[model samples]
Target: MEIGNKEDNRGYWDIVWNPPGERTGIFDVIKGTEFRIIYHDESQAEVSFTRTWDPSLEGKAVPLNIDKRFIILRGSSGFYTYGIYEHKEGWPDFGLEETRVAFKLRKDKFHYMALADNRQRIMPMPDDRLPPRGQQLAYPEAVLLVDPINPDLRGEVDDKYQYSCEDQYNNVHGWVSFDPPIGFWQITPSDESRTGGPLKQNLTSHVGPTMLAMFLSAHYAGGDLSPKFTDGEYWKKVHGPVFMYLNSSWDGSDPTMLWEDAKVQMMIEKESWPYVFALSEDFQKTEQRGCVSGRLLVRDRYIDDQDLYASGAYVGLALPGEAGSWQRECKGYQFWCRADVDGSFYIRNIVTGNYNLYAWVPGFIGDYKLDATLTIASGDDIYLGDLVYEPPRDGPTIWEIGVPDRSAAEFYVPDPNPNYVNRLYIDHPDRFRQYGLWERYAELYPDGDLVYTIDQSDYSTDWFYAQVNRRTDQNTYQPTTWQIKFNLDSVSPNSTYKFRVALASSTLAELQVLSKERKKDLAFSYLHPSFFLSNVITGNSSCMINVLAQVFFNDQDKGVPHFTTGLIGRDNAIARHGIHGLYWLFNIDVGSAWLVQGLNTIYLKQARSTSPFQGLMYDYLRLEGPCGC
Candidate 1:
């Protein structure tokens, strides 16, 4: 077959292999295949594929395009591209009789360890060419098309390194185009809109880049600059400007005016490049001063509510004696930051100074007391761990909502709305009387204490758990419910996790997880939610899996020693089948999306069953994982 054509009296062709089969492989064949090519000079040159597919094999190329020949191949050993040209008269390779083929090869540095779903593409292209048109430039061979309209000589492939061959690389030639910066730029004081710290080096969180290889990159790029080296190309040694570091931006509309020396000290100071910057007195003062940054965490009992101010509370940081006036006085409200849904907050870009942090909430009866003593210097980023409130809970008790008591089932909180939390269990509530009018549970606990609160629920699972008198009135059995709380933050992030909810009963009840968040996040609707599990439930055959466990389904089959009801005989009982009238278990999994930092409520509610006398009972809830869930 005709393989290549003349390009201004030059012939070119590039090859690629398959990927995803093996990191590297040896072809186990030799008998019949050969590379066949008919040249324009009415001459033929052939290379046999009869040998082991590798890089060491080299063969002569037909002198086509008048004075050039081609021998190109790739293998695990290394990539080889040879273009033998006439060395009738020359200095370098004057008798070597060749120029190199411009085809470029790239190595996949991290392919063996990557999973099939995670592996990247490997595509080879010609160094002196442009890639094929309309090709997505990523993977197997990620081609960078710099001057597409001008010329490109490399073809794009799905995976140029695939073991099978179906196409060839493209061919185009041109130089990358850009010019040196023009004119000049001056640093003028910007508007007050530029919000930053008291210092100029405080570039509002944009810090300097860090690396060491930059100063020696030119030597690394081409060793020809060294007297001991001579293999460097002539052009790389002759082109462009050089700097210890260079920062640039481009606008093709006027490439000539793209960049200029702004003369601004870019906050990129390095110990070795001290001579680069000459600062003024005011500029030096800014650099000498520092900033303070940290996260705020309250005691376990104190709810990290974001709208503390709206709730008649505020976290304050101020001078030590600022609040010691005849009347309590405080300043610097801008120094305060509210906590996030996760009870985490950050104070950024504060000028270095001494300060005290204190907070006051409506229900929490206390005067301002310093939670921390800050001594900040230039560029200081401080992080304070969990703060403990002295005597976390005290004074008269207050009730946020509902009747509070022990036991998982039968809660008194109403439904949750957007603004107000109806079912809230903040810390441990104590029974108290409010003004002798109504007796209520006081939501008083030491600050930062663990709190479990259910914010919403439907009435479907209620009467079954609440109607205790129904259990004795009717001959029919009543269903049961269990409510539990856990700190999801306790589970590490980016990990697999599993939990089991088990109930011991003479009969089985239809179990449902009541939390909307849990239903949407944790896998809950019957076992094997995904087809990846080897124990396929619906339509799955392959064993390769990426997802985690969808809950282990363990049914109760044998009779219990304590509550034995079913017959020991083989074929008599007609009541029990598929987890009915027995104790069963389901493993709940909260994959990756962890729980909030505080107390997270989990509810297990059971409904009425068809069994005659079997009563629904609660057993236990347990967590088992971070890895093998």
Candidate 2:
């Protein structure tokens, strides 16, 4: 279907897909079966297109029905579109790897793409990615524009994945046409129907003069995020009602102003969520939705005796499962809100259902899950009084490193190699997204691993962002050990200590605790020095297994790890140039006998060394002395 002002060829945009080659099958195509008008009035109009699955074509086509809808209100500057995907109870089993709605703009007209204020730039033409002009890099998605129509982009890298952003900030992004001074924007009002949580990264606008409304994708989070149906299970979901907005300079203003205008329009759409104009019963109206409100307070006695307001806390309700299930939940809707300065939050327009309230406050180490399930009915305004979150803490803090904000952005990120730079992030805040930073770890520490002293070292400068493998030779990598040194004036032999660590991201990696009594000999505690665990959570479903990290004291093997993060996560945040993938917390108990009065050290080793990408990023680490010590 055509969109935008048809009279002006520059504004014309269409939904297009590549025709399947000879090897393509019927299931690959979204064949439209029927189209009909749902309603028509002076105020608004709605239409639906249904693609029903045929039993006769079961072996060849996907066993499902797909319904797509579009709506436009009078005097509106944009239109809304949504879709429904369903599979019958007796349908054949299949897996949905990826699904998204894409729009191809007029290539000649839209030359500049804007993802964020600092991320917007004139993009390379589609032809620039061709052989003679471009040279392929590690993957086909990445290419070096060796020779481009515009000499400025020459010697720069062009990768669509480089422009990915978290779902929280992916509100409005599109292309700006300079000739006629027009903009084509895609605006997502809410993420309730999305798969991963707020931090999940997905693609946005890229070259080819393209814009996308991502619904389900395996871009950052791998196979776990892909939904698979087995035994003909009945399933259905509403993808979106995202807005396609168009704007132009009315008084001969700069075309770039359209981006700011689109941002303002985005807020307007967000405020009008649960749009009342949709005719489908499946799309709930404002009256059919509910609101949840409460105040969140945190009590970490080590920080203060009185409860502190959990300001800027991320509070949300999702399908009840576990304390941190919200990040991996893909089947249902989620409603999230940020707590205000006084720790107050008001989550509105949530679809009626049973949910568990989940929250994580900045500067805290663990997640908080409400004890009771909340049930919301139509027009229900539920108020849960004061809720308190006591973060995981066992004693007074001896020392701590880094922040507990579920991100490794606070750590030191090295500059990218000059030969392989993106140029856009040379001095940008997101310098962590640069390509080939993993190899820098080996270069910075050619002879030994990282060593940090409690009072003398600064985490911002001394601590590396990720614990990557050290390249021994060409095509070979080996695990590395980092040391943390601390001192105590006196030690209580009968007390127990708490060693807490939080990881912001992990990928096919395992953490092992080793002890070194004299700094000369390597000693093992629980597992024998020759013992090894074969598999890890690789994020690839076909080849996944449980992985673990251990802890030790004074280079003494404590029989078993005080704690082990068995089979944690597979978010490949390191290679993606992201600060975090998934959040994980572990609290270990250390025997006081392992501590000496003067000098003590703890060694943390990442056991996985097969690939440069196998590593983990620490969010925060702390060692707490026993209470009343």
Candidate 3:
């Protein structure tokens, strides 16, 4: 059979994939089997199936058939094109060259089929109708468009509109556009007619740069829509749920200027984080004395009520004793402000000085003394109490107190006299003692004094026992003296001894004696002497002696029962008799020998009615053996 001219590519043909050197045609395999036919148009497409035994193809040898095929593909330029062809019965009689076979079985069957006809008139698919993939494939339908020309439906419409006279995409494309980019408005301070003008101006001036940057970021990321700007009514409606700025006026003037004004009026609502600052004295005035600083704890009613004063709050502090002057110090603390709710603030880490705390908010006035004088000592913490700001007539009352001024005291004691081998004496000057309330007096002496006396001798016995008394009476007693007596014969002539006397009272009393003796009979003694009366002595009172002593001797024989004795008798009775006088004899050496560790106890009991004057007095007496020559 003769095939069409190799260059005359003018008809559509079905594609078939065959293995190398295979003789079977694709129709032979599909003749007895069922096959599906698919057709696509620029706007819509469909797929159908027919069995070999179906009635439509009963008498026909080639059962497959497709009618009215149409496919339109669109180009970037606003135009559509299509490839047209008509299929005839029976396969074409042509030899299958490698090149021809390759072209007939291209991987993209749709493209191969379109190009086989050698016609550039391919139908262009409508922008809205064509699926993202091939025309014959199943896919979702295009979204509907909305018109934006109507003022009432500007934001309400689904499809964006534009001027059709300009670019076609500008009109047909579904995307919103703004004349001035988002965050294009410049805010400024407004006049008195604008209530929140000052604040709006401040916020815009302070934080506008940051907000502008964020808006620019959103624009760069292809945000869905431009940020909307509003003021007064518009602001209340659009950003009512959140915090936003209120433009002073919307007369279509300079957007930047209006934005600046709006920003000033814009607040973070009571629910946002607070901005706090510290207040102190004017720098110029405190330049020499050094600046005073403290923290401010601001609370916003909308954000948090429980932790309103917990850091980040507005606080004011005045120097110790000074409350009127206020200055800005640090940003370490912050607080939120709200019109409907009350707030508390705490100012801490205050300079080591005095200060008054105060707070001010819209429609409210508050002041308090942070009487907390911070001393900046090691680990010192100062709590300036909670400062609450309430509406007028409901705020807390102010209170104040004066810190007292006082000084410390000084005292001294004189040195001991070395030449006199006597007890140390202490004398505090009358002037120094006058501040007795804050002063303490004490006297120190060696540990071995025979007797000690206080100048106030007329005091009660209780005073004597307690050993401390106020010398109210200026009268000085000569016996306000401590005494120590040394009997040369009682100690070894050439032996040395050391002693210490403590002039102490019942409060602080101690006496220690140490000695070295070589005499055949040497004794160390302490005598507490008193007086006793005797009835047999005919109205006579004699001295009685009470003694504590230690006796030592080299020879064992000399350590006898009579080694030490205490004699007691009336002077008159002693004088009446000669060498053998009437007296009571107590042998301490005998009693000590019979007791363990040579310990002895003695008691002298006087009978009742023994004498008219039965009072007792004690005297000291001593005797010792001479040193062997």
Candidate 4:
């Protein structure tokens, strides 16, 4: 093993090893030595041990200098750097319900130590209070990171932090700050000095050695998570019309099209825009549409890659195994582009061959060019030269354009004369004394001006506007609660306003955003209190439940929900786009309370049991307030 010299706050890095004696009978620490961070190069995944570089022991394991280490890691800074690790011959003694799942990533993990602060997230030390990871920790395992000042940081960084220390068995116990801070990082892990010993074994004597130590650490998801069958047409005929050209400009005016010029304008309006859609075996209708282009020459700029302006960043385009990761950005096998402003990119069409480009620019880390590999043939142009990268030294001068331009800069700025209009608009029969500011959701509440639709609504195909409930005792998932009561006469009602509750949740539990004047959970705000205990899953093919369209209101409208890579599938479960399904996290303002002129009730607590195969649902909810919403 060799890796030496990188410290000086580049997140510590030095592996170099040579200890391996004992061959006559097999016992040099059971034939293993340890130093984890794997994905396959040896399989058996879990192995985050320690050998302590003795930064006095930045992470612990000093008795006899176990392997002499130095691994701090921040993670997938941009499509993994030095990934696929696994040196084991051994390393897994400590307590054991679970240990290295985070930083070791794979749940679509992307770095920031597996997505910022919580680093590779997975605290779960359970009632023992703490001491599952490598041992020795009585206090000090809370250390947050990433406030090197907060310039936006995606996933929204800026964690509150405590500076990582970990001892009484949570293990890490030294040298904090390895880049943390990302939305209040807090791993309390308090309470588990269990005298720093006991646990010797349990889970039924490690059930046959923890199922042979999780099949020698390869992790088998038999608990069910289905979605590894692939072949959508063989992945649209090998990543069809192959796209992915970050930093645009080979010609094709940046609309960020490596693939998906709006799914090729809906396959050119489903076959007809001058034809040309062959994904192989000829789905016929050809006229040619195969493009690809590039250019990301970052000359040499470091203050952390010019503080990660890293030239328009994010430019993936994989295809050839493992392409369904990180929440689902790898859906259908990778294809992300956006490196314009000079990084240059293009993709008129695709379906070529051989690819792996990768690029990312948050704190400037991996793949500016660390193995981009490419090749195209079909309709022309394949220039993928120029990918020079070299950014990392205490990174983060401040970056983050991610999350779709910070949610299109929130309304991309343009409120006009807005202070909140559209005061009241009713449909359906939501009961609110003659309310009808002019039917919008198509009509449902208390039937005021009539627009009807719930006599047994079933509308499908989704545009994110469900009202569908096929009532098999409900849960064919459609309608749960949709209402609007009034009394403040439209405006001026005790001031204080911030209602942005969109909607969704075909019953997982507790989603109250009540708003009465005197009683009824008084002006409450609850939402997801056991969404089926973190949504149960058990797939062999038929164990689906993935909800992420939040907006349960009541935190004073700092409003957050934004997800929209578009998803809400259901021909009968299992077929997603940006990751699993049910996507559409609308702008959640969902109201915050204060309207009190007369009668006001905005309650929505109904769903408890419904199971259209349990597809947890919700629909187009853009409720704004002020005049008559």
State which candidate has the highest TM-score. Answer: 2
Sort every candidate by lDDT, greatest first: 2, 4, 1, 3
- How does candidate 4 score on lDDT? 0.25
Residue 607 error for model 2, in Å?
A: 2.0
For candidate 1, the lDDT comes to 0.25
Candidates' lDDT values, in order? 0.25, 0.78, 0.20, 0.25
Tens-place lDDT digits, model 1, residues 1-629 = 01232342221222111122222322211122334332223222223221122223312221111111222222111111111111111112101111111211111111111001112122222321234442433232223334333242232222111111000100111111133322111111211111110110111000011001010110100111111111321110100001122223355443222221212221222111211121212112344543343333334223443323223233444445422110111111124434444334455444356766654332332224454577767767667654433323211121122111111133332221222111111121311100110001112211221123333333223212111111322344334333444443354565544444333222322344232322232322323111112221100111111111222122122121111112111110011110111122333454434344455444433343333322332323344445422
* lDDT minimum window of 10 residues, candidate 3: 162-171
lDDT minimum window of 10 residues, candidate 1: 204-213
Tell me, by lDDT, which candidate is best.
2
Candidate 4 error regions (>4 Å): 1-226, 229-333, 339-480, 484-606, 609-629
Error of 4 at 275 (Å): 40
lDDT of 3 by residue, 1-629 (tens): 00322432211222222222334423221111333334445643333222222335433332222221211222211111111111123332211111000011111111100101111111111232223321221112111212222233211101001000111001011100022212222111111111110111111111001111010111100111111221211111000011112222345454334333323333222212111110111111112222223333344332345434323233444333322122111101111122223343333323233334444342112222344543332233444444443221211111101110000011121232222111111242211111111101123322321232223221122011111122223432111112222222122333212111111101111111111222243332323111111111000011111221232222224443112212222221111101111111111111111112211112121111122211111111111122131
Off by over 4 Å in 2: 1-29, 54-59, 515-568
TM-score for every candidate vs. truth?
0.18, 0.88, 0.14, 0.23
Residue 604 error, candidate 1, Å: 46
Q: Candidate 4: TM-score?
A: 0.23
